[model samples]
Target: MIIKEYRIILPISMEEYPIAHSYTTTAVIRQDLALGDDIEISKSEPVTNIRLPDGKRTSGHFVHKVYHLRRQVPKWAKVLAPKELLVLHEKTWNAFPYSRTEFSNPEFLKEKLSLRLDSICAPDRGTSENIHCLTPAELAQREIIYLDIAGEQIPRKEYKAECDPKIYRSTRTGRGPLVGDWQHSVSPVMCCYKLMTMDFKWLGLQDKVEKYAYEAERKVFCQFYRQMFCWIDQWYGLTQADVRAMEEDTCRQSCSRANRPQGLFGSKSAVLLPARAARLVPESKSLSLPLDPSTGF
Candidate 1:
């Protein structure tokens, strides 16, 4: 016979959860949250203890204390200048599915969200006018506060982190150019195989793809791409000479940047002017345009 002892985990309030407050856009992430709020869980300390077979009490938290879930805000998202944490008091608020917004337009929300027949959001749907009209059962539902910037939903990809900063990454070598990675040429635009194909689909031809013979050389496909741009320029009343002049100027600018003196960044290539930073990407190994539009090389 053996006696077993188990230590139970006490659930902490949302306020006590380390990540709970990080989501807040307020000046102090945790100031609004009180220590004694209605809680799903609570703990006096962040850790729970378990006794080992040798009777040693080892303590550990749910996550490594050193690793915080909500890390630094992405540089791009931060540049968007998000303001206000919009809280939805009621679930019935119509219009966008987002329950909360980081950017506040309170008056617009108040005026727009309504149950009135003529209200812009309601659309004559027979739903209760106010949240108070709902029963306790109905009131019990999932509440989510989503981040919104200015007037648009933050990109879905932004919410999900693609790279882990904590993990050290070694430089990759001798690999074939993957589908979406940039082309080999150094230029004023970091034109990738993916971006070009997408640009081809969205910008130049709404539904048409460039036609070529089965034995067509790589230059043929690239020329088709350039010709489409030239055609677009012609449509916009630009002559071939104007196109040539513009191409020369752009090429000169690109070459000047490529040969410019190296700066504090150590590598000459790394030191790009403000305008040039968006231009050149590190050269890819591939020399040819992807033949397959569906799966770029």
Candidate 2:
């Protein structure tokens, strides 16, 4: 098992993050659809009194997604790998400021592999206590990687001036063009402590595949947040109701669209990972703050 904690500090406030995140997720899902990946939102609803790993209960929204990604795998692998291996099942329990997502494949991988993501959002400057409450073994095995949205290097083909944090500025919030040391000086700064855990046991392929998964995850996180921040003006003033409406519309559209086959080759790094191009293995479970027994969100 490979465990890693990724800390991403953004120049957005805690209050605005939920909206921005929701908007970004919907947009990314749509982009995947446009690329010909079949996305199925089998479940999207509210949940209450959900038990946490720490024995507390919380309430929030839950979502289940299935990605049919045969086209996202290389042609050679398509001939070698089983069709079921190309499909992915995702279950997300989102209680704002804290969310847990699990990813797995059906049948074969359902028991041998596990991928989880636990996200804790805070308004601090990237230094919060051990929010996920890792056990001694987990703590010792985990690696901490900080994602610098503005400073990280990107491939030329993947770079977009519009999404570059060093260039774009939000007109509405006036919070942009994050320069060096922005994580320390930006107003209303927030941090997302994303804990990712992956346990894959195969024929000597575990280590290589796990390493590639982390790299792919880092690429996704950096690019996703860069776009999220750059598109701040669009999601800045959106309310929960507005996001919900947009999601409903997206769900409707997804249901109506035909599930066309596509290719594994794409501009996005998430799809171009040569090792496992079709699967996204980001996941988590948690510990730091007091769980609101009443609301759970």
Highest-TM-score candidate = 2
- lDDT of model 1 at residue 231? 24
* Candidate 1 TM-score, true structure as reference: 0.14
How does each model score on TM-score? 0.14, 0.82
Residue clash pairs of candidate 1: 11-41, 11-42, 12-41, 12-42
Tens digits of per-residue lDDT, candidate 1, 55-97, equal: 3454422110010111122343235424321221111111110
lDDT of 2 by residue, 1-297 (tens): 888888989998888776776676566555564564554445545678855645678986665656677665446557766877877776777666677877788755778778887877878877865777888888899888888999999999989899999999888988879998888899988988888899888877677667766776787778778978998998988877797677556544544454322221111111211112112222212211111010011
List where candidate 1 sits over 4 angstroms from the true fold.
1-235, 260-297
Q: How does each model score on lDDT?
A: 0.20, 0.66
